[model samples]
Target: MRVSVDTDRCCSSGQCVAAVPEVFDQDEDEGLVLLLDAEPPVQRQASVRLAAGICPGRAITIHEE
Candidate 1:
């Protein structure tokens, strides 16, 4: 699985970070979505997908390979 977040469309919402802290985080200055890991542990895939779904800005995208 791969994860990607569009910074341009992101609104600094912390939902992704809250849902998948292992794969997502916030920039100290902007508080936007910061991808900590693209290929996270297998245990985190569901949470990452959940985060993408809950993102109001629709900035999160997940790909399964």
Candidate 2:
């Protein structure tokens, strides 16, 4: 799975970060979504999906490769 984040669409709600801190983060100054891992381990797929779903801004995109 590949994870991509559109920072421009991020609302900085931090839902993604809260859901999956290992995969996502927020810039302190801009409050934009920061993708820590574009390709996370298989074990982290669920959390990544959850984070993507919970993102109010729909900034997170997951692609299964």
Candidate 3:
């Protein structure tokens, strides 16, 4: 699984980080979504998909392999 985030579209809601802190984070300076793991471990795939789906700004994208 692959994950990416669009900071330009982020609303800084931190939903992604809350859903999957292992794969996402928030910038302290800007509070924008940060991709901690572009390619997270298999165990984290489910939460990653959840994060992408719940992102209020639609800033998260997932590529399944």
- Name the best candidate (by TM-score): 2
**C-alpha positional error of residue 41 in candidate 2 after TM-score superposition, expressed in Å:** 0.3
Best by lDDT: 2
Model 2 C-alpha lDDT per residue in residues 1-65, reported as the tens digit of each score = 99998988999999998888999999999899999999999999999999999899999999999
lDDT of 3 by residue, 1-65 (tens): 87878999999999998998988999999999989899999899988988999998999989877
Model 3 alpha-carbon miss at residue 56, Å:
0.6
Which segments of candidate 1 are over 4 A away from where they belong? none
Give residue 17's lDDT in candidate 3 (0 to 100): 87
Give the C-alpha lDDT of model 3. Answer: 0.91
Residue 31 of candidate 1: its Cα lDDT? Answer: 91
Query: Where does candidate 1 clash, by residue pair?
Result: none
Check candidate 3 and list the clashing pairs.
Answer: none
TM-score of each: 0.93, 0.96, 0.95
What's the C-alpha lDDT at position 29 in model 3?
100
Rank all candidate structures by their lDDT, best first, as comma-separated numbers. 2, 3, 1
Q: What lDDT score is found at residue 57 in candidate 2?
A: 94
